[model samples]
Target: FIVGTITSGYYSINSYDYLHKLWLRQLIITSFHHALGFLPSYNILSSFILRWLGAHIEDNVKLAEFQQILRFPSNLLNIEHGVTTFGRASLTSFTMTKEGLCYVDEIYLGSDTNLGNGCTIMPGTTLPSKIIVGSLTLVTQKYASAQSNCVLLGIPAREMPFVIPDDTSVINDLSSLNSSSIYSLLFVCLSFFISKYLFIALYLSSPVAVALFIHAILFCAIYQYSILITKRRSHFTYSEVITHQQYFLFKLMSEFSTFIGPYLSGTQLLPFLFRMLGAQIGSDVILPDIRCITDPHLVNIGDYVRLNMGAYIQAHTFEQRILKLAPITVNHRSVLMSNTLILPGATLQGQNHILPWTLVMKDDQLPPNTKWSGVPAKQVP
Candidate 1:
């Protein structure tokens, strides 16, 4: 009995220690991810953190803010030098079958590879060097043997007969033009820590509901004040060197919006908050996710509109290294379904229904009472 008791106690202590370490690691990762969302110099900062976490990330790799690496240890992921990623690329190292089986493996990206916005790199996939992947592409393990110097596009990401350009110099130029200073990151960290502690103190002293209400009010007031002081404009060309400061300020505002979106999303407070930030939001609008609208001030939404999950309103685009800004209008009673992307200068007339996964191109205007569907959205009879 004595021997059995001693063995069980030893096992229990070991289990507890293991669980504690696991929890601490997860906490650190989550905190790091949230902090990186608002901080500038995303590529450099993220690469440093990722290397610390044991990922094999080489020099000169550009990782965009808000990208996701999921379901694998950091050591299982490998990224080579000069690889660049744009907007929210997801590298998932695990997959589950319908029958409850799971597969997990390493993911590798070769040198000078580029992944576009909203692309997915599946488990066990290996991308070759000098490969250019288009936006919204899905790269599977079958492409592991693909040749370098090719373009990949579409849902399943088939290769196109196009030669990949050596745009390393261009990427470096853009990075210099757009990178935010460390001071901005420090400011964001300070604000976040102060707000976090304030909320904790309030929660300890007051009822939950009252504490939340007061915190929300104070947060909104501070956020609005900051926005007002920035003196932002609706339209501006972003190519000139003189406008770099203004561009950085614009990025800071965007980061703030992204940081606070989850707290007010799907609530009545969201529309009010957007209005305070200069958006022309009308009555009875249902905004499930505010993150979808990158530039709220450049957006105008009419009455009784419903924007579903993943419905994106992009008010700006970059062409030939020049940033073009425009307004997006969703007329009264329009419904934007899941994953609908409305590009800059796109307008949807009254009572229009945009189906799931639709892409409304720039400057495209749809008629009233129309139902649209597909990648480049077309009217569905």
Candidate 2:
């Protein structure tokens, strides 16, 4: 009976310890996301922040360069050593089911691989060596294990039939970045921050600092507390349009992400944000401003797609009191040029290009590999 009591007590202690550590780690990561510090040398923030989150970062990985966009949420990552890549991620998921519950998990990038600009690596993925993932590639599907020696490109991320070249250029390009110059920028920003704040502290008798500190603390507390109450399981559906409940959750997350989005670029963050908000955004796709994202829960975008500046893609419209809801699917390698407007139910197929000032009508089906133009867009020969 004594042995049994001791074992039970030991297990209880272990459980408590685990939960405590998890909570602390989650708090730090969550706090970093909210800070949205996007100074010229914000990479410093990502480097230290990732280290604190138990990520194994290698020298000159340059992953920190994406700190403005990439996030390593504490509870959702377990990165290993020897990774070399230039890409960002919406990577988070532990476990999942078809009924839609996601448990956070590690998303890995194998050593000597490169995910080029506009590439999106989804959660629950493990890539192996000597691979090159092309720009705007969407990795929406889940891979249970590591894949090696392949090139994945385009919407839906199909493997190229031929073996692509290895990524030696990612390492060779470091000299062009001028790290010393970047360090100088960091120093200037740091000095200015300290000087400005120190003068305020002294001139204002420090009470202002105390009040501001208290206010910040209260803000953080309220923000975290609200998130807990609206806690959601991160998951994406393959097809079906999101329900009202999913819509509400995603919209709330969008507001939060958007508030902090401008401090840093959303190139690396928008996909995750849209997904969290019930939009089916594919891998490696680079969207323009999402401020024009109307009815995001009904939107779907394919891999390797690009949205030029001033593009407005909508999924819902109202004619008087009557409301219409439909899905917009922009397929792989498509381009929506500046000032383009895609109304509800428009499906743009592979390699389609919409010229500037084009306005696609509702339920329009754009043919593949064609260039379109005009107010009510038509094929341009």
TM-score of each: 0.65, 0.40
lDDT tens per residue, model 2, 204-311: 775864754443343334334433422342222211222223333343334334544553233856666567556788899777665656556678888898887777
- Say which candidate scores most in lDDT: 1
lDDT of 1 by residue, 1-381 (tens): 101101101112235432343234445557677554554433355676677667798776766553365223466778998777766678863465565434546788988787766678887788888777766678887775557878776567788666543542323333442244354446556655654565467779999788666655655455555445224653333234224344344443443355566877888788887786568999999898767677677789999999998887888753312346788999999999987778889998789999987778779999999999865577999
TM-score of 2: 0.40
Candidates' lDDT values, in order?
0.66, 0.53
- Which 10 successive residues of model 1 have the least lDDT summed? 1-10
Please identify model 1 stretches exceeding 4 Å from their true place.
1-43, 65-67, 97-101, 129-134, 143-152, 159-264, 317-324, 376-379
lDDT of 1: 0.66
